[model samples]
Target chain A: TQTVSQSDAHVTVFEGDSVELRCNYSYGGSIYLSWYIQHHGHGLQFLLKYYSGNPVVQGVNGFEAEFSKSDSSFHLRKASVHWSDSAVYFCAVSARAGNYKYVFGAGTRLKVIA
Target chain B: AQTIHQWPVAEIKAVGSPLSLGCTIKGKSSPNLYWYWQATGGTLQQLFYSITVGQVESVVQLNLSASRPKDDQFILSTEKLLLSHSGFYLCAWTRTGEGTLYFGAGTRLSVL
Candidate 1:
């Protein structure tokens, strides 16, 4: 079974400040990791995904995430956030093969204040 | 461009009432469909997934059932609504050999 964990339930940051949303996962075999952002009252939007090769993947809106095998982590980061970035971020994981059932984290609510 | 649409943007129902939510995909065929539920301020939970017509698999049982009568349509229904069933319902789809899921706008259901 694959599981994802996002330790922080909420994080507040000032506009133009860099932010990092932490995510960690536990799975036995090859896995696919991805991030999604959901604004209030809206469905989630896919940000980025990592399967192989690049440890760091860039996403839309200047967001990026780095995958670390040793830490079993895939943390999303943005050098400078805008107030519009205020939303909930989710980290998801799935097995590379088999059922490919996607498992999502609890999510971290990010508040980018001006 | 592919589009996924969910019906009845929002719904309010009483307990013991039957409920049905619908989702349709356009510009795509034979796509894998999934239903997800999220409580207020809670994480998303996968309810069911269908890779083909008439073959729905349940991931978590919440007294809810799903069906895919047509290749492009997925339906989520329950015989009776429960307070626990009140939440946001989202439908998503992905092509074979693809990892990304495209989601619908979702339906907000309130059970009294």
Candidate 2:
């Protein structure tokens, strides 16, 4: 079965510092990777997605992710964190394009301290 | 722009009581609709999906049934509420070429 793993249960970073949220997947087919952000008491918001062409995909709010086929991973990175960036980040994987039925990770909650 | 709407932003019900949750989709024709349940501090678990009007598919939902009564409406119903069923229920929709899911505000279900 397809599965996604997010090792970090929680992470803390100070404003103006760089941060990385890791995600790994174990799937046999071509995978479509995505990242979502959820604030407390609200629905999830799509951050970014990556498929065939580019290994690096940019998302809203200055977020970006890199897909490494060799590592079977997609990790999110930000050069400078802002206090508003504090939220729970979830990594998801889909088997095919437009299928959207995804296997999500447990999520990594980031606390950005100002 | 496409949008999804879910009713009863929050619901509080007693055990053995009937329950229903509604969702409506807009700006897309023959869109794929989905219902998902998320436990507190847990990831989302898909419950049901509807690919077309009047057709619905179940994923791992327990003691719940889903129906697509119209082209843009999906309904989730249960005969009796369970305390374990309390959590966040989300409604989502997507198109064949859209990899992203447009979600509703979500309904917080609290069963006693």
Candidate 3:
């Protein structure tokens, strides 16, 4: 079974400040990792995904995430956050080979204060 | 451009009432459909998925069932609504080989 873990339940940052939301996964085989954002009262939107090649994948609205094989981690980062960036972020994982059942972490709620 | 739509944007119902939610995808053929539910302040949990017409697969058991009656339609239904059934229900779709999923606006269900 694949499992995803988002270590932080919430993170607060001021506008223009850098932020990193931690995520870690445990899987024995090839896996797909991705990040999604859900704004207040809205459904989830895909941010970015990593299956192969580049470890660092860029996403919409100036967000990026790096996948680490050794650490089994896929942490999302933003150089600078805007007030509009405040939302709930989720990290998901699935096995690349078979039974692509997506599993999500509890999510990390971001608060960007101006 | 493909579009996904969900019906009954918000619903309030008493316990033991029957509930049915619908989803439709347009401008796409043979798309993979999915149903996901999320509790307040919680992560999304995928309930069902369908790869083709009349072939719905349950990912998790929530005392609910899903059906794909047409190429573009998916329905979620339960004989009795429990308080635990109250949550946001979202419909999503992707191409046969695509990994990215597109989601609908979602239906907010409140079971009293």
lDDT accuracy of residue B33 in candidate 1: 95
For DockQ, candidate 2 versus 3, the one ahead is: 3
Q: Tally clashes: model 2.
A: 0
TM-score of chain B of each: 0.98, 0.96, 0.98
lDDT of 3 by residue, B15-83 (tens): 999999999999999988999999999999999999889999999969999999999999999999999
Worst 10 residues of 1 chain A by lDDT: A94-103
Off by over 4 Å in 2: A97-100
**Candidate 2 backbone collisions, by pair:** none
- The deviation in Å at residue B108 for candidate 2 is 0.3
Residue A23's lDDT in candidate 3: 97
Q: Which candidate model has the greater TM-score, 2 or 3? A: 3
What is the two-chain DockQ of model 3?
0.71
- Per-residue CA lDDT of model 2 for B1-112, tens digit only, reads 8778899899999999999999998887888888989888889888998888888878886999999999899999999999999999999887776567777889999999
Report the Cα lDDT for candidate 2.
0.89
Q: Which predicted model would earn the best TM-score?
A: 1
Ranking by lDDT: 1, 3, 2
Regions more than 4 Å wrong, model 3: none
